[model samples]
Target: MDQRVSSLAPPTIYVVDDDDGVRRALAFALDLDGFEVETFESGEALLLRDGLDAAGCLVLDERLPGISGLDTLRQLRARQVALPAIFVTSHPKPLMRDAAARAGAPIVEKPLEAETLIAAIHDLLRGPTR
Candidate 1:
């Protein structure tokens, strides 16, 4: 019933962050690099999305306002959706990094580098090990 669901595509990337500027920047950069990108204002917005295509990676902010990014990642995994996610965070704590690694996701720092971000996206696009 959702319009977004009707046009989902594999190899797509979703950027979820509370900051409008960050979301826009990431989306623009990825779009220029030939990736279909969708921006969400919050983790909840992303959670409500439908028709997830395989090979898609979620780029979520670790400090989302309402729903913490770690919790969101846990919920997704619990639902059997093994999406490869790259967390963007301003504060990089050891516990956060460990948790992200445990979730099989990578953490990219706040001021993201273009090449590194691209590489992370590429790795996610590669999908999980068989």
Candidate 2:
């Protein structure tokens, strides 16, 4: 494959959330917004996936069934997956905020507005928030 060809491909957004409805909604919205979206139901499922480096970003839920989103981020970092990430959670606690900051991932709270989440993704893609 040509380098130029691959470079022209749409960016892939990896979404890790337990809720089926959220995943479907996100995938649909993001696709409509002209991005390639992949959905994972758990941190464990995401961890099992290959080519994490190929993704443009990750939108993760703070509380997951298998491993919390924070832990998933930790594990990904441990494996040297440096993709930009953000948390989409409802009312994240202070501790989670601190951890997310430490990890350099911004948190966009739930009841999510497409514009807000999209803006966050675009901003993070442009440059690190920190």
Candidate 3:
């Protein structure tokens, strides 16, 4: 086994999106980019799993059915789960952006370019300053 690979646990990406196509497409893309992925249809599904303790980042759609992505992040924070998160949405209003910022999540607009999302994920994994 490669020493580097053995030294670090594989990074898993938790993706929460209401759109079936979008969730599947993102999982496919991220998998191809060499990241492990877990998909949820809604923020509620993710919260129910109680599996956020894993070493990974979160890619969430802002306007989820049950709990909004920002609210989900807030809940996670309240629980002391500090995973890096990125929010994607078609509507990028100032209020949403501010909320996401407060949660320490970057908001990416929908109709996302695959490369950009991938790059952002990589950057987040690298750490906040990177």
Candidate 4:
């Protein structure tokens, strides 16, 4: 973990989902786990934000209205953002998983299990290789 414990800040988790219910549920779950969280309705909203590096991880839905999750992840990588991210979607095809792996992002399918989601969150906190 490349985290600085003395920074006086909790690790922030950014959750980006176009669906209102999903965004709310995920945010609630993360918050309940004592993580600082920020929720966004779309990739474009997140793209317009500043200081993304402050976040410890990003939990993003693979499909979005504009600038899809994969594309957003590509942009983030292009910008050299090192934040760990996990991609979630209803359609977790082999090709998508391969691409995500290539981009250093991991995939988590929808109907997300509590255990799996928490484990992924831990893995994100653990760092990229985990």
Candidate 5:
């Protein structure tokens, strides 16, 4: 993942996806949109990162190597991280869909439309009440 260091810090969007292509593509796109993105290949990696409580948001794949996205989010929430999250999935199962709803994260289906993800990020950045 690419992070453009600037004198002015942009909003931080932590992205966790196993697919290197997807992770790098997202970092490139979000970077253009003026976000400081840090990427991870697994929930374990993300979990190990510092400063998630101060993060702006998260974009997580529904499936991962070690922990599922839901479990990752749950652990974060359990720690009271409270960062808003979006799930990107190629094929979403009904059970997972239901769980995502319970988690209060929107699912953006892949072959991802950048606009959709960007809009969601903006909305999340607005506030929890949005």
Candidate 6:
């Protein structure tokens, strides 16, 4: 069998942040950590893309250009795409926390500790059984 044909792809981390600097930094960090990373400038872009059903998780920014992170997650859930998500925000409010919790996504406040974000991603990928 051809190695390319049989080889499995690495798990992907879908990152959606409007800020270029933040998005790039996250992609770099997650890439270095041995996971494939895909980035989008806004939640809308992520929703427009296909292949979200792939094995992986999402790292979304709460304040997006068009749709908020919570709304994005709600849309994904409506479509039956229950990929584990970690929401990052610089200014988190109680309402946002409540919404995130309702969507089954954990919200992590910024400036993000690399270890914490990485650990969250790992834990999410591991599934709830862990």
Model 1 lDDT per residue over 19-81, tens place: 998888888889888888999998888889887666788888899899988888887777787
| Better lDDT candidate (1, 3) | 3
Candidate achieving higher lDDT, 2 or 4: 2
lDDT of 3 by residue, 43-79 (tens): 8888887767457999989888888988887878888
| Candidate models: Cα lDDT each | 0.84, 0.91, 0.86, 0.83, 0.88, 0.88
Question: How do these models rank on lDDT, best leading?
Answer: 2, 6, 5, 3, 1, 4
Worst 10 contiguous positions by lDDT, candidate 4: 1-10
Candidate 4 lDDT, 1-130, residue by residue in tens: 5556656576788889999988888878888887888899988898888898555898888999988998887888788787888999887888898999897788888888756887888877876452
Best by lDDT: 2
> Which regions of candidate 6 are displaced past 4 Å?
1-7
The true-versus-predicted C-alpha distance at residue 99 of model 1, in Å, is 0.4
Candidate 3 regions off by >4 Å? Answer: none
Report the CA-based lDDT of candidate 1 relative to the real structure.
0.84
Regions of candidate 2 where Cα sits further than 4 Å from its true position: 1-7, 53-55
Better by TM-score, candidate 2 or 1: 2
lDDT of 6 by residue, 67-102 (tens): 988888889888899799999998788888888888
TM-score winner between 1 and 4, please give it. 4
lDDT of 5 by residue, 26-126 (tens): 99999999998999999989999977736478999988998988899999999889888999898899998999999889899998988889998998778
Model 4, residue 47: C-alpha shift (Å): 0.6
Question: TM-score, each model?
Answer: 0.86, 0.91, 0.91, 0.87, 0.87, 0.89
User: Which residue runs of candidate 4 sit more than 4 Å off their true CA positions?
Assistant: 1-7, 128-130
